[model samples]
Target: MKPIEVKNLKKQFKTTEAVKGINFSINQSETLALLGPNGCGKTTTIGMLLGLITPTSGNIFINEEELNYKDHQFLNIMNFASPYVELPKKLTVLENLKVYGRMYLIKNFKEKIDQLIEDLNLKPFLNKRTGELSSGQKNRVSLAKSLINDPKILLLDEPTASLDPDTGDYVRSYLEKYKKENDISILLASHNMDEVTRLSDYVLMMKEGQIIDHGKAKDLIDKHGRENLEQVFLKLVRQKNEH
Candidate 1:
C-alpha cells in the first residue's frame, strides 16, 4: 500500500470550497509535489492530511488503513514542517526540540536531538530563543523538529524558503541523503520551480482548487513545448487567465 492515498478528498469553508475532490498518493520513498498558484488550496490539502482540518467528504489512507484522526500511533509515523507554522517563540532552539521530541515520545531522545543538531548545523544557536533566530536559522530548527520522530511520511511546505543559496542547496542535498538513508515518503508544495525539478519524482499542477495538469516534470515541460518547469507553470497559469 502507498504511504499516503487520498480519494476524492475535499474541504469546504462556509460557501467556499478550498479543496474540490482532489485525489493523489505518495508511494514509498517517493516525492510528489503539489504545484499551484497562491490560494489554490495546497495548504488546505496538507492540513487535511495532517488531521488538523477535518475533511468535508472522501477519505485519506495511510499504509492501507483508513486514517483514524484520533490514532496517535498513525500520527507518530507522520510529521510536517512549514515555515508558516511557528513553535513557541519564547522557547530556545534546544527547548523547542526537546518539547517536540517528548511529544513524539522518541526513544533515546538525547541522541536523536544531538544528531539533528549536527546534521542541520544548529549548534550555533541551539541555546538562542527561537524568536530571536534569523529566518534561515528558524527554518533549520523547524526541520529538526519535524524529523524528531524519524517519520515515515513527511509533508514539507516551502522547505527551502528564506535561505541563502548556499544554505538552501545544503538543505535540499540533506533531504536527498536523508530520504535515501531512511524509509520516507514526501509531499512537497513549493513555488521554486528549480527546487521542484530537482526533488520531485512526480508533479501535480493545481489551479482554482483543481488539478489542471500533471506529469513528470520534464514530461510536462516537453508536453507544453517549454524549456523548463517555470516556463511550463507560467504557460498553464497564463492560459487559464486568458480563458
Candidate 2:
C-alpha cells in the first residue's frame, strides 16, 4: 500500500469552498510537491490530511487503512513540520525533544534523542532555550521533534522558508540523506522553486482550489515553455488569474 492516499478529498467553510475535491497520493519513499500561490488552499489541504480540519468529503488512508480522525494511534505514525508552528519558548532544545519523545512513547529515548542531535548537528545548542535560538536552529529543533515518532509519512509546509541559502541547503541535504536512509514518504508544500526541483519526484500545481497542472518538475517546465519551474509556476498562476 502507498504510504498515503487521499481520495476525492474536499473541505468547505461555510459558503466558501476551500478545497475543490483534490485527490493525490504519496508512494513509499517518494516526494510530491504541492505548489501554488497564497490562498490557493494548499495549507487547507495539508490541514485536512493532518486531521486539523475535517473534510467535507473524502477519504485518507495510511498503509491501506482508512484514517479515523479521532484515532490518535493512527496519527502516531505521521508527523509534520512547518515554519509557522512554534515549540514552547521556555523549553531548551533537549527539553523539547525529550518532551515530544515521551508523547510519542518512544522507547530508548536517550538513544533516539542522541541520534537526532548527531544527525541534525544540533549538539552545540542542545541546552539553549528554544526562544534563544535563531530561525535555522528552531527549524532544526522542529524537525527533530517531527522525527521523534520516526514517522513513516512526513508532511512539510515550506520547511526551508526564511532561511539563508547555506542553512536552507543544509536542511535540504539532511532531508535527502534521511529519506535515502529511511523509506519515508513526503508531501511538501512550498513556493521555493529550487527546493521543489531538487526534492520533488512529481509536482502538483494548484490554482483556485484545484490542481491545474502536474508533472515531473522538468517536464512541467518544458511543457510550459519556461526556463525553470519558477517561470512555469508564474506562467500558470498568472494565466489563470487573467481569465
Candidate 3:
C-alpha cells in the first residue's frame, strides 16, 4: 500500500503560487526524494504533508486515511527531521527525547531511549544542552528526537547537510538499515544529489512550483543523458527559464 498520496496539491502565497497541482504517491518501504532548487516549493509541499500548512486545494492521504489539519489522528505515526528546525536549545538531548517519547506515549520510554542513544552513538552528549552542541552533534540529536516515537513515516530535509563526510555516511547507513529492518517509508528533501541517489528509489524533480519530471532514479539519470543525478537536476532547472 502507498504510505502517502497527494493529488492536485497546491499552495499559494499572497502573490505567488508556491505549489501548483502536484501529484505523487510514496509506497510503503520506499524512499522518495523530492529534489528542487531554492524556490521550487519542496518545503511547502512537505509542510502540507506534515499538516504544518493548509493547502489551498489538494488531497493528501496517509496510510489510506485522508489527513485533515484540524483532526490528525495519525500524527503519532509520523515524524519529521530538519537541521533548520531545532529542538529546545535549553533541553539536553536525553530530555528532548524523553519529552517526545512521552508525547508519543511510548510503552517503554527508557528502553527506547537507551536503544536510540546507543544506536545513534549519542550517549556522550546525552546530558549536554542542545544549543551547545556543534552542528554535527545537533544534527545527530535532531535525528534521534525524530526517531523517539518510532514513526512509520519519516520526513527528512537535508538529513546530512552539514556533517563531515564520515558522520554523514554514518547517518545514511543508519537510515538505510533502519528502513530495511522496519519497513519504514521516508520522504527526503535534499540538495545533495549523491545522498538522494544513494537513498531514494524514486525521484521527483520540481521547478517553480510544479513537478517537471519524475521517475525511478536510474531512469531519470538516463533520460536526461546525464552522468549523474546532480547533472540531471541541473539540466531540468536550467531549462525552466529558457522556455
Candidate 4:
C-alpha cells in the first residue's frame, strides 16, 4: 500500500516558487531520500506534507485518505524528527516525551515512553533539560519523541547530522530495524549521501524547486557514470545550472 501520494505539489512565497508541481509516492515500509541543494524547496515540500504550511496547489493523500489540515486524525499516524527543529528548551527529555505522547493520546503513555527510553538508550539524559543536552544527545531525544506515538510514517531531516560516525551508524541501523519490524515508511531529507545510500530504497534529486532526476540510488550512480551518490548529485546539479 502507498503510504503517501503527492501530486502536482506547489508552494509559492511572493515572487518565489519554492515547490513547483512535484509528484511522488512512498509505499509502506519504504524509505525515500529527498536530495537537493539549499533553497531547492525540499523543506517547503516537507512543510506541506506535515500541514505546517499550506500548498499553493496540490493533492496529498495519506493511506488513501485525503488529508485535511484541520482534522488531525491522520497527523496522529505521522511524526517528524529534525535537529534543526528543537523541542521546548525548558522541558526535560521525559517531560517533552510526555507532552508529545499526550498530543497523540497514546494509551499507556508511561509504558510507551519507557520503551522508547530503553530502545534509544535515553536513560541517562531523561531528566536533562532539552537545551542543556549536547547536539548529538538532543538529536537522539528528538528521534525518541518522534517515535513516541509509534507512527506509521516518519519524516526526518538530517537525522544524523551532528553525531559521531559510530552513533550515526547506530541510529541508521535502528531506523532500518524499526521500519522492518513495524512496516513504517520514511521520507528523509538529507545531504549525507552515505546515509542516503545506506537507508534509502529510492532517491529523488531536486533543483530549483523541481525534480530534475530520480531513480534507485544504485541505478542512478551507474547511469550517471559516478562512483557514488555524492558525485551523481554534484554532476546533476551542475549540469542543470549549465543548461
Candidate 5:
C-alpha cells in the first residue's frame, strides 16, 4: 500500500464541482507535485486529503488504511504545512510547538521539539510570539510544527512562498534532507517551478478541477518541447484557454 492514495476523488460544493474524480498516489520516500492555476481545485484536493472537507464521492487511503473522517488515528501519521495557514498569533514559538506535539500525542515531545528547533534554526526566536516573527521566521516555525509528529506523510502548500531567496533555499534543502533521512512521502503544491522540479519525482497538472497532464518534470518539459516547467505550465494553461 502506498503512503497516500486517492481513488476517484470528487468534491461538489452545491454545483461548483470543486474536484472532478481525480486519482493519484504517493509512494514511500517520493514526492509528488500538484501543479495548476489558481482555483484549479488544488486546494480543494488538499483539503480532502487533510480531511478538512468531505469528499462528495470517492476514498482516501493513508498508509494503506482507508481514512474515515470520524476516526482520525490515520492523521497521526500525517501532517501538513502551509505558510498561508496561520498559527496562533498570541502563542510563542515554543508554545505553538507544544500545542501541536500534544495534539499528536507525541512521546518524548521535548526531544523532538529540541531537535526541530536546532534543525530549522528556530532557537533564536523560540520564545517570541508567532505574529511578531518575520515571514522567514514564521515559515520555519510552521515547518517545525508540521514535523512534530515525525509523520510518515507530509503535505506542503507553497512552503517557501514570501521568503527571501536564501531562506527559501534553506527550507527547500532542509526538506530534501529530512525526507531522505526519514523516508517520508510528500505531496507538494507550489507555483515555484524550480522547487517543483527539484523536489518532485512525479507531477500532476490540474486544470478545471481535473488532472490535465502528469509525468516526471523532465518528461513533461521534453514532451511539451519547453526548456523548463514554467514554460510548459504556460503552454498547457493557455492551450486550454484557447479551446
Candidate 6:
C-alpha cells in the first residue's frame, strides 16, 4: 500500500465548500505536487491531511491508519514544512529540534541531532534563537525539524519561497537526495513551476475546489501545447475561468 492515501476527501466551512471531493495518493519514495493558483483549495486540502481542519466528509490514510482529529498517532510518523510556519521565535535551533525529537521519541537524540546539523550545515547558528536567523537559514532549520522524527511522509507548502536562488537550489537538491536515500513520500504544494518540474513525480492541478487535470509534468505541458509548466498553468486557469 502507498504510504499516503486520500479517498473522496472533502471539506466545507459553513456556506462555502473549500474542497470538492478530491482523491489522490503518494506512494513510497514518490513526490506528488499539488499545483494551483492562490485560493484553489491547496491549503485547505493540506490542512485536512494534517488533521488541523476537520474534513466535512472523507478519509485519510497514512501507513494504512485512518487519520482524524482524534487520532494523533499518525503524527508520530508524519511531518510538514512550510515557509508560513515558524519555529518558536525564542528557541534556539538545537532547542527546537530537541523538543521535536523528544516528542517523536527519537532514539539517540544527540547522535541524530548531530547528524542533522552536519547534513543541513546548521552548525553556524546551532544555538542562535530561530527568530535571529535569515529566511534561508530558518527554512533549513524548519526542514531539519520536520525530519527529526525520520518521517516516512512529509507535506510541504512553498518550502523554498522567498529565498535566494542558491538557497532555493540547495533545498531542492537536498529534498531530492533525502527522498532518494530515505524513500520518503512527499506531497508538495508550491507556486514555483520550475521547482515542481524538478521535484514532482506526478502532478495534480486544482481549481475551484476540484482537480481539473492530473498527470506527469511533461505530459501535461505537451498535452496543453505549452512550453512549460508555468504556461500550462496559465492556460488551464484561463480555460477553467472561461467555462
**Residues 103-196, candidate 2, lDDT per residue (tens digit)?**
8999998899999999999999999999999999999999999888899999999999998999999999989999999889999999999999
Which ranges of candidate 4 are over 4 A from the true structure? none
User: Which regions of candidate 3 fall more than 4 Å away from where they truly are?
Assistant: none
Q: Write the per-residue lDDT of candidate 1 for residues 6-41, one digit (tens) a residue.
A: 999889999999999989888999999999999999
lDDT of 3 at 65: 85
* lDDT of each candidate versus the true structure: 0.93, 0.92, 0.93, 0.93, 0.95, 0.93
Provide the clash count, candidate 2.
Answer: 0
Q: What 10-residue stretch in candidate 6 is worst by lDDT?
A: 62-71
Q: Write the per-residue lDDT of candidate 3 for residues 30-148, one digit (tens) a residue.
A: 99999999989999999999999899998999998889789877788999999999999999998999998998899999999999999889988899999999888898888888888
My TM-score estimates for the predictions, one after another, are: 0.97, 0.98, 0.98, 0.97, 0.98, 0.98
Q: List the residue pairs that clash in candidate 4.
A: none
| Model 1 TM | 0.97
Model 6, span 26-78: residue lDDT tens:
88899999999998999999998888999989898888778858968888888
- Candidate 3, residue 124: the lDDT equals 89
- Which wins on TM-score, candidate 4 or candidate 5? 5
What's model 4's overall lDDT? Answer: 0.93
Model 1: colliding residue pairs: none
Q: List the pairs of residues colliding in candidate 6.
A: none
RMSD of 6: 0.9
Candidate with best lDDT = 5
Backbone clashes for every candidate come to 0, 0, 0, 0, 0, 0
Off by over 4 Å in 6: none
